[model samples]
Each structure stands twice: as C-alpha cells, then as structure tokens.
Target: MSMSLRRRSGHGARLGAAGLLTFAALAGTGAAHADVAAPRALPAGCSGTSPITCHYAVAPGNYDVTVSLGGAASAGQTEMWVEARRLMLPATRTAAGSVATYSFTVNVRQPEGQPTGQGGTGNPGLNIRFTGSNPQVSAVSVKPAPQPLVAYLAGDSTVCDQPSAPYTGWGQVITTAVRPGAVIANYADSGESSGSFLSNAALFPALLSKIRANDPVFIQLGHNDKQTSASAYRNNLDTMISRVRAKGGVPVLVTPPVRRLFDGNRLTPTALHVNGVGVNLPAEMRAVGTAQRVPVIDLTAKSKALVESLGTSASAQLFLRSSVDGVTDNTHFSQYGATRIGELLLQGIREQRLSLAAYLR
Candidate 1:
C-alpha cells in the first residue's frame, strides 16, 4: 500500500477501500457488529445525546479516519482515540442545520506482548467521545494506508491531552498543526517524570512496543523530576534515548515549558523547591541533548520569552486561572496557551527539518 493518502469531503457515498463509513443512529434495535461496512447505523448503545462514547472494532493496520457531525445549531467537541492513544481532530462546531467535518490519520497497531483485550484480540479499533451541548455524530470513514510516520509524545501533564475544557495540553492541539500523513501518539500524563514514566508499568512499555523504526519520540520531562537528583534525571533521559535508538527510533529532547513564576517584572525560576536544588532544568536538558546528539526543542526558553513578553497581569491569561480551576496554576496552560506552545513545537520540528516534517500539513 502507498504511504500517501488523501482526505475527501462531502456527504455520504463511499469512495474505495479508503472511503467514508456513514453511521446511523440507534433505533432501540440490536447491538452493532464489528465487521459492518459503510452506511451502517450506529449501535443501539450510541445516541445523539451529549457526552456519549462509541467504539468500533477494526482490523489491525494504519488508517486515515475522518469524522463528520451534523444536526443542531449548538456547538460541541468530539475526541477520538485508538484505545488509550489519542488522535488529533479539531473541535467540531456546526451552525443550525449545517454540517462540520474533522479528519486525521492514525496508526492502529495490534496489541504487542500482553493481550489486554482493550480493543479485543487481533482486532484493533477506534473510540470516539462527544462532549458539549447537543452533540451528534453523523459519519466516520477509514482508508487503509502504509505505515505512517508516528511522532510519539512522552512527558508530563503539560504535554498530555486535557480531557475537558478550561484546561488543555499542547499535545492535544498539535494535531491541527500536523500535516495529514503523520500521526501523533501522546503518551504523556499528569505528574509524570522521566523516572516515573519509564517505571509506570504501562506507559513506556506500551510506547516502546508499538513504536516502529524511524518513529520520532519527543521527550520532555523535569517538572516532577525536580524531586529527583540531577544525576538521576539526566541518567533517566539517557536511558530513554538509548532505548529509543536501539529500537531504530529517533529521540528528540524537549526541555520542559517554563512555569509562570515572576519576580516583579522579570520571570523567575519556578517556586517548586525541594532539597535546596533550584537549578535551571532546561540547561540540564540542553546538556543531555548535546551529549546524546539528539535534536532539542527549547520549549523552556520559548515559553519564558512568551511569558516575559506578555508581562505579569497579561501573562495570567496563558495559565489556568483561579476563576476556572479554583486555583491559580502557572505550571499548566489554558487552551490558548496550550495552542501557542503546540505551535512552537511544530515550528521547531519544521526548523529542524526532521523526517516527520515531510508529513506536516
């Protein structure tokens, strides 16, 4: 199969092996089957109600999937995933009696090592969840393609996909900036560091097992690693880089984004002090990148520049405010801030001319 794939828009008709799969609403009928083709109605379980999750069983391979929404004048958002791995799609909003479409390519790999039966054995699939008011899913389509160049994100909460509104992560918004052929698999989670991510039983192992040769793994740690010794932190990064390289993967080091700690007019180090160690973590990441010969995305400096340029009162907009999360947090970002950071990362990828750039939309 050719690695190249094209996205088509419009209503209903199926195209080819790689065409649209229209879904019908559940009519209080029987259950939905796995192998059912296009123009099939949604199962009895999935309805037009807000905040409903639907699953589909698909053959294990790489696919370019597109989801379309219709009905209602209200706005809504939907998220798609291949099991735990998230697929990037724009927030869907439609006018009264109009339709909205969002599309992205994803690699659906069979479970390696342990068969958790998350998506069932041998047969892998996609999961879609609708959020917001009056959300309704109209259709979904999938086309087979050659293995995609996957860019996997491994880091902390700042890089993970935020589940709800008011809080968002750069990883979640990056899909919109990425070109069609490449897919991003965000494995980052809240409160994760280099050490914890590798030891977290499922995270690192799952990423390593599915990652193919030439896949790029973007790693950003250091927020939670502050508790860990500098030596230990560097070693953990080294080990991760080595492991990724051993698998024929490319490891790109990303310094953690800066916290919104300000000293009067100037940005200051984050107030997260432990054991009297308040060194600049980005410097450490830079040193590791130099030593390991891996490309580095200096998100720390870029975020700091952005914050400093915005000044104190104005910079607050970039972070989670007390009004939204009930607490002022400089460590995490708001949706606007997350989108900016994601754009910065995408710029870095392009500037570096990484192989993944070829797939950028």
Candidate 2:
C-alpha cells in the first residue's frame, strides 16, 4: 500500500500512484515495477517555504529508502528520520534545475502509538524533512530492507543525537562510520545518569524489549552519575548489564567522554571529590566493567588524550559555542567535534574487535 502528497505555496493534498507516475515520466524515468512502490510526494501542508516534516505509515521491518530531490538550487541538504531516529545520508549538492538522489537502509520499529514501552514523541513511521532555501523533494521510495544487526547506545547528552545545529552528539555522527548491515539506535538523553536511564519508563525498557540475541548494547554514564555515590553508580551499571544479558543481548560498557576542562597547561581530572576523597568516575567505570566481565570502551582516556593534544584554543572549537548564547559549554559537542568523537568511538569498537566492527564503513 502507498500514498503520496504534494506541497505547494497555497495548496497540498494526498496523491495516488498515477500522479507519481506522471512525476516519474517528467523526470525521464519509467514507472516502478512490482515490489517497488511508486514514489510519494510530500503533503500540501508540508510547504516548501520553511523546513517541513512529513510522516508516512510503515510496518515494523527494515526498508531501503531512496529520496530524489529535484529543483534544487546551488546547494542544499536533507535529513531523513525513521520514526524519531535519524538515518545517515551522504551529502548531496546540485546545480539549478538538476536532481540528486540519496539512499539508505533503515530498520523501522513499531510506531510509538503501538503497545511498545518505548513510546516517546511523534507517531511511529517514516519521516522526511527538507531544510534550506528552495528545498524540493521530487520523490521518495521505500521497500523492504534486509534485516541487519542492531546496536543500541544508552548514556547521557554527550552520546545522544542533538536535534539542531551547533549542538551535536557522538551518537548522531557515528552512523556514518557504521557500514551497511548494521544500525544504531541511540537511546541516550540529556541530564540522564546511569540510574535515571534505567529507571526512566521510556528509555531502557524500550531498548531491552527490541534488542535481539547477540546484539550489543553500548552503555556509558558518569557525567550525571557523579551526583551519586561511586558504589551506587557502579551498581547501576551492573544492573543494566545484567538486564541486557537476561534479554540475550551483549552488554558493552563505555566510560563517559571527558569534559573539556583545562587546568593551566594540563587537562583536569574528571574525579568527583566526596567525603574528603576523590572518586575517579572513569576508573570506577573500568572497575565495574572488570567485575562484570564486559568489554569496556575507555573513552575517557581517549578523549582526554585528544583534548590535550589539541590544546586550549584549538579544542574549544569542539564544544558548543555561540555569540548569541554567550555560553561556552565544555560538556556538549559541536558538529565537527561530535564527528571526531564519533570516530574515536568507532576506533574503540574496532580495537575491541567487537562483532559490530564487521559493519563499520
């Protein structure tokens, strides 16, 4: 089953395949054959004037999606989302009156409206978003995609996918590093500690329920866990590991990324001082991984090393900064920085020789 819509300045409405066939012929392409649904146009409500998002109903399965952009000007970009998660697409640019096509394979889970405990924002389905001046989408095609191994990321803001520009997380950028046949579902959120994540009704349970056997759940915490006792934080990690294991999922521990805190000429330690003693959060994470016998990604050490190598002025470019906000945040990452950190995470995955490495691009 398929439906299409067209968005114009003052009008928009659902269209049938006949309209899509006309569009295909206009683009000098033949009609779609069996097994390939005709391309769908954006609903009229999705005006081309501003950034518009449109949703399409889809079954709970993997799909290969192809988006054809027509009428693009000098430069433009598009971001595609399956449900709430972003799918990585290569950058595309076109000249006046030209067309550019991008493709990706995504695993679509049941929409949030379903009985799944992973409910959050928006209906469960496919979402297409176009951003930029004169952004135009000519056609969108989705077909059943091959089932691929999945990986889940659970942590704090540092690992989550930030919604807008100037604010990016490693999770969003890491998708580019993941080769075909593997998908990443980042469940990380801001202000979430190890305990809060497990306790959150929508986050961890949703991940646990969907994870299949042998799939890896990458767990990272410590930034917010600093508020709690070291032992308690470790306990939370252990609990998460055990629960994932109970579901036949592989649990991989990841120490949180280092904060860009510089003290004079050296990087500051991420140790929290409690009761006259300093508790090293990353060390605690490593200890927990050892005790639980789970492979740990020592991102703390890796990130700190990266920052020290870049120095103060240069490394500052990695964090969130804006003249308007007048706030320099060391905890979060800008797009460039997030991409670098994402690469580092990829390196860790490769270093450990995790099964997921087979899917790295």
Candidate 3:
C-alpha cells in the first residue's frame, strides 16, 4: 500500500518467504531481492485505487514466470479486478539452447482501515509457479524495502556517461559494483570536464539540472584539468564540490586512469597518453580530494595495480585494440576487462564498508 510496508519494513530478510533481496557481487549470481528489477509497470487490476505496492523481480535465468489467483478457506480467492492481466515472461539472460528456469513474486496488501482494493480482500493472494528444466534446485528469496540514496557521479569523457559502444572509460565499473537500478547514472562525455561539463554552452548546466538531494556528485579530471596546479579546471574542485553540496548533493572525486606505458624498470602510469586517454589524471585528482576532505576513488591507483597484476601481456587484452596510429587506445577498457574491473569495484565498495551492499541486486 505504501512505499514502506510496515511488515516488510525491517532490514531482516527471509530466505524462502517470497522476499529476500540479493545484491550480485562479481559472481553475477541470481540477483538479490532488493536489487532485482521489477518486471514492468502496468495498469493495476486490483479493484479500487488506494495506491498498492507490488513486490516483484526476476533473477538471472531463462524463466517462465506466471501469475494466477487463488485463496484458502481462511480467506477469499485472489480476484483479478485490480490486476489487468497476469504477467508471464519467457526465458531470458541465459544460454539459448540450454534449458533454464526463472521466478518472481507479487505481494498485495492494504493498510487496514482503507477501502479494500482489488485482490486486497481477505488473505487473497496470487500463486506464481515455475516448471522447466531442473524444477528443483537451490535458490534464494526475500522481500526488500526501498533504499535511501546519498551519492551521484558527474564528470566528462573518462568519468561521465557510460558509452554503449566504442569501448571507453571505467566509470561504469564504479556503478556496477556499488549498486543497481536507479542508484547510479553516468553523465560523462569523451572530452568533457569541470568547465566544459558545465558551460561548453551546450553541456554542463544541462547535466547538473537533474540532480537531487543527498545525491553526491563524483568528479574525475586531470587530462583536461590541465597540468597546471591552479587553472580554473584544477582550482574549481572545491568550488564545484561546494556548489554541489550547497544544493544538498554530496561530492566525490576520482583519479584518472594510468597511461598504458612501461617504465624502464616498471609500469609508468604517467607516459604518452594520446587519443585523449586521461591517464594519471585520477591519481592526481585523488590528491586534491584528500586535502579538501572529500572522498576519493583512486581508480588510477587501483587500475595500475590491476595492470601490474595482469602484467602487460595479459593486461593489454583489457585495453582497446592497438592499430597503426596506436588507435588512440591508451585509457579505455575492453569489455571482458571492464567486467573484471566491475568486480574489483564491488570489492572497493565492500572495503569502504558502506551500507550499499543491499543495493547489489
């Protein structure tokens, strides 16, 4: 009935009671209860319009999710008055020829005292069933409450919007590991920054226009912040952060990616970075953030460590393919490698020890 169901309000979760939320870590296993996405929004079939809340989500698999109405002697049968139609989804998210199954649930309720809505009468409920290959297996379930949000990411080129193609920055890594659903949105561009992201006459303002309360902003710059220590690009960190905070948005800063180069003795993060690849920027950005008392995501340091761990031979697979002209492929990541970084980002979230694991689905 309400966004916060009083009964499902507690943080505690039931393993098989049709409502346990699971946030997928690197494993990308079955999604958690809270982190799972709702099937879709449709007209309510339940009679009356008293604002009922639906608890439903599908985990990763090929599923045959179905909904039907029924009731027990203790109560009435679930009526379809309020529900326009029961949803039935076919297999998705798994291998095509492989047999698999998926499941989801819908919970209906009234706040007691309000006029009953469709399916709100008695203890009437919908019975969701599944039948496919391997009908019986180990699975988890739980109902989850909405999460409180407190951060946002805003940047350009390397740390902004997640480009669908032409492999680019690692910003998506942060979001993939930290939360799911509406928890994060990337507003970065391939060649934007504090100034260009804001002014560019056609950029900045439009991006910041949609941010809301407690939604912290994360900034990553260096390649474009310029090498100078006091350029408007570099100097604006605090001012930009303050302006964001004044608007009730928290602010975070991230270092740029390390240049894909090898020192005579070891990996040199600060080397030739063409193709607008902003290597070493994140590392430098992290420094200013430390002094400013702002949170910092050391992607540069972390990425450097990742490259070092994989070694240049194995790590090169993560970067864009090198064509003649070097293809300007200095900082961007490959898809397979991007997933790996996403896994690491989740580890970072855990290391930071924030209350964000609940959003992992």
Candidate 4:
C-alpha cells in the first residue's frame, strides 16, 4: 500500500506532477512497476522515467515529504532533488538506497525560490537513510536539541504552522519583539528532522547564502532533531554553528522548550525527559555560548522561570488563545507568547554585547 499527500497552497489549486512519475515506493520494492500517485509525484524538468527522478517546485518555505519506491524506482538506484526548497542532495538517487520511508525537511530558497547555499545536514525535505531493513519513515521517539537564540526553525508542520501554535516551536515569536532589523527566519517544518532538513536541496542552501557578516542563526531543535539521531543533533549543531561562523553569521545555541509537565501541582521543566535529563538547557547552553564565543538566550530557562512565576495553573496563559484549534497551546506561541520570547532574545543579544546590539531596540 502507498500514500501521497500534497499540502495545497492558499492561493493555488492541486498541482499534478508537471511531468511524469513512475510511481515507485521508496522501499526499493521489487514489486510490479506502475505509476502510483500515492507515493510518487514529480515536478518540472525531471525526465520522470530515469533512475534519477526529481520533484521540483517553485514555492519557498518548508515542506514535509514522503518518498516510496515500486519495482523500477526500487531495482535501479535513484537520486532525488526538491527544486525550490533549498539544501544539498546528490544530483541523483542510486539503487543502493532504500525507498520504504518518506523524506521530510523544511525546504528553503531565495525570495524567488531558487537553490542557494552549501547543502549540508539539517535542511528539511531532502534526506532519508535507507538501511535495507529500516522501516519507512518510522520515528520511535523524538526530543528537543540544544537550541540557541535567533532560531531558524526549519521543518515541516512542526515549524510555524500557525501564528498561535508553538508546540511546534516558538522561533517566530522569539523574533518579533527584537529590533526591526534582527533576523529570525523560521524555516522549520512540522515533520522535519536533522537528517532530512540537511538534504532539502534548496532551503538550507538559501539560508547559507542569506547569511550576512553579523547575522546570528539561533537553532531551536530537538522537537525534530531527536526524532533521528542518525543525523545526530549535537554534531549537526556543532557543524551548523561552524558553517554559520565561517560564513560570518553568529551561531547561538538553544535548548528545546520544556513540555507542559506538572509535578504534583508544580510546573516542572524536568518533564521533557532526554536520557533522564530535561530540555531546560541553561548549563549546556552557557557552555556552548562560552566555547563558541556566541551569546545564548536560554529561553528554556526564562520560559521555565516564567512558568514558575505563573505557577502550574497560570502557566497556560503563555500560549496562544486558541480558536477551534483549542486554547492555550504550550508547545507553540500566540502573538503574546511569540512577543515574550522575542523580547527575551533581544535581551540575550544585549547581554552578549554583540556589536549587532545596536540593531535591537
């Protein structure tokens, strides 16, 4: 069985594979070959019949994707490319690859939607490690990673899906209260992870290209980074920071937001368990900041402090006021939440004394 879903754009209708797709599942299944719309979809410029197939689109931002392979898509190796959403990937797929699982990442690009940047890991919508026995797109567990200020939240649905939902992450809100020129490019996808986000082919590259000499790229990971350790969030963070610094962008680290966990009526940050450790990351963050010589925001600490002040009951007030989507979401933010976190980031910038502080009001 196969499944395919196209997230329709607000202004566009359902787009067919502008070319042809040889409907094959990602499992490298040796089953009969036939184009199945469920698992395979193609975009412009792809031959649609070759071993290296591409699904390109001109849209920007993040996306969640599932890729499967049928007989032909499986027997022969395959190379994939998601055109508009940036990052880096092999120009083609090989027969040695597994096809059972779906690939998810936050695709990024230039304002006009073109690929730009050093295609590395943590890009959305452009990767999957197909070990022969690995089941398709299965995430046994997920946790947050060491996050920093100036979050570049990039993933599928887990990203800024709504102005109100921070269960995904709160980069948007974290960016707002800062001075007007500060950059908070929330490119995270709701369903993306370190493995896939790095391979998206467009977005990551664009992010790299977009880096200015003084830009600080804060990463709020773990929500998805923990889902796939093969891509190792810590290592990725280390590498991403190096890249950002190499490109002249300051790299701040952040820990994932704590879950809405309460302990016998007390709001506890310890509930977001990671190897018996929680995600409230001030210690780890402070070290990373000192080691990397970049400022750390410690939003997790501040948020935890705020929760402590609000108490377990009032803690709910930090989230967005829901409409039909339910109210008081914790994982994400509302305008109010985003605003608060954004202010925290601005404060972090000031404390760090980055020359860029002049940009923050």
Most TM-score-accurate candidate: 2
How far residue 18's Cα lies from its native spot in candidate 1, in Å, is 33
Give the per-residue lDDT of model 2 (tens digit) for 1-361.
0111121221222334322111122222212212222233564334454465666677766666666665433334444344443535423333445555545556565432122222244556666566544455666777776767889889777777565556677886666445446777777777787888898876788788888889899998778866677778788888999999998899999887777877885776652212123667778888888988999999888888888889988888878776633568888887668767776787788789998876654
Candidate 2 ranges beyond 4 A from true positions: 1-54, 59-62, 69-87, 94-101, 107-120, 132-138, 144-146, 271-277, 324-326
Q: How many clashes would you count in candidate 2? A: 4
Ranking by TM-score: 2, 1, 3, 4
Task: Report the C-alpha lDDT of model 3 over 1-361, residue by residue, as the tens digit.
Answer: 0011011222322333322222221111222222122222222332222222232333311122223211111111121111112212211122212212223322222210011121222223332322222121122233331333534445544443332444644444433222222344444555655565555533335335545675656676555655434435446676677777677666777666565687643576354222233433454456567777777766666767877877766777767666522554756666445545544544455455434434443
The global Cα lDDT (0 to 1) of model 1 is 0.64
lDDT of 3 at 215: 62
lDDT tens digits, residues 1-361, model 4? 0112121121211223421111232223222223422334332323324333333433444344444543233333433333322211212232422333223233334432212222223333222222222112112111121221233444333234232222423443332122222334555554444555566655555467767676666665555544434225555556677888888877766555555678866555453524233332345445666776766666667666666667776666556446524665556554445444544555565676765454332
Pairs that clash in candidate 1 = 18-143, 24-41, 24-42, 179-360, 179-361
Clashes of each: 5, 4, 36, 72
* TM-score per candidate: 0.74, 0.75, 0.54, 0.50
Q: Indicate the worst ten consecutive residues by lDDT in candidate 3.
A: 1-10
RMSD for each model, in Å, please?
9.1, 10.5, 14.2, 17.4
Query: Candidate 4: TM-score?
Result: 0.50
- Please say which candidate is ahead in lDDT: 3 or 4: 4
